[model samples]
Target: MSDLSRLSLNQATIKYAGMEQAVSACLRAEIPGIGLWREPVAEYGLRKTGALLRQAGLTPTSMCRGGFFTSPDSDQRIKDLADNRAAVDECAELGVPELVLVSGGLPDGSRDVDGARSMVLDSLAELAPYAGERGVRLAIEPLHPMFCSDRCVVATLGQALDLASRFPAEQVGVVVDTYHIWWDPTVYQAIERAEGRISAFQVCDWITPLPAGVLLGRGMMGDGCIELRRMREAVDKAGYTGPIEVEIFNQEIWDADAMEIAELTAARYVEHVL
Candidate 1:
């Protein structure tokens, strides 16, 4: 296998592509792995999707998400746990080893960030073992602080690691996404401390004047200010010898040809990440 064997395309990078299209693009690009999102997998039917991936020799590096346990509503919290449990089951069925968890931000009209974080821990305590039982590791993904108000309160790798440390390394781990945590001053140290708890490494360049809601503004590699190679080296030094998934969420990229996007992503991985 070539060095690019460690490169994977996250489905979100090409939101316009269907599962079949994405899989075909990955095969066309000679990419070995992919990161899947829950909705698409469900839409494609879990068993069928798993079979397709296996037949094509494609590995599902990780699943998109299985968390949102920051709601102050008791019923909502219960429902969130139930949904996460189902996500864990899907991970097992799809043979995915990692299920990324994006801890939701503060509750509606609330300033209690601490309370929200505590709820994440509480939810994990219940879901971690449930996931572990099915041989799936729950990966806590810390989004950028800009998303701390509505998306994910876990805004740093250290915060993710701190939460993951509460459980066994095999049952819980942290996702190191450069797009999310690149500006963090202590990211390298956190990577080192995450030694055995690094579950997935996602890459995307950071750009300014983020789009309206700031959800679809990620720049392609080499188009922004993040030190991509430096971050890759840090994750490598931390003993994470897994796929470096390119997870750009830019609308412009999404509107491009899916196959071309895959090819460009691979080339960018070579130029900026490897």
Candidate 2:
């Protein structure tokens, strides 16, 4: 089995860094895989971003996101689909393995989580084929239940696996991020059930006593209560031998030097997860 030493850096950890700057930091630290966000790509231009990453010999792990299937109006839904199509093209251009899908939450003026989930699946059913033709696997990343209202509706590993089961193994997968799923009662068994459908495994510690209306305050590994070693074991047991990507969205980390943050994140993941 491969050790958990191969940790990838998700750019959100250092959101203050520009595209070229982040790529340079990862390259300097010899990190192998990176996850890119759309805003930075738009700011730096897709062709330039891809060329620079290639020059630096970095692998684009997965696009930051491309799923928001819970909008009330058909107009918004069409817009989201268009935006997702553009994201898919970017992934194909960068040769990224998967497009992380954080299926969106309840629609406006509605409280129907199930209906929103249905919308997500329906969108995936349509988009997966197009993405497959481009050699980009769609990875469903189930957000924590705390985000069930506005961020993502799929809130468990089993829920994600069930969605993936609707498609072929190669066409669809899931991102098992510890921060979002650690509280799940069935996480271990669900990972076992995930089998080969686990495409990306992200790590981050979840902080408690969150301030009101604060959506993102992820702590670094070992800073919060998440059992990093156990989460790694679950993914490994499920036969997912991919690089464990560290995705911390902390405001404090963002204010630090990009290189230092990347190095510290790598060290922490290795320290706690191995």
User: What's the TM-score of every candidate structure?
Assistant: 0.98, 0.95
Each prediction's Cα lDDT score?
0.93, 0.86
- For lDDT, the strongest prediction is 1
Which tens-of-lDDT digit does each residue in 42-130 have in candidate 2?
A: 89999998899888888788787899988878898899999998889998988888999889888767888888889988999989998
Q: Model 2 off-target regions past 4 Å?
A: 1-5
Tell me the deviation in Å of residue 253 in model 1.
Answer: 0.7
Q: Model 1 reaches what TM-score against the true structure?
A: 0.98
Clashes of each: 0, 0
lDDT of 1 at 191: 91
Top TM-score model:
1
Q: How close is candidate 2 to the true structure, as a TM-score?
A: 0.95
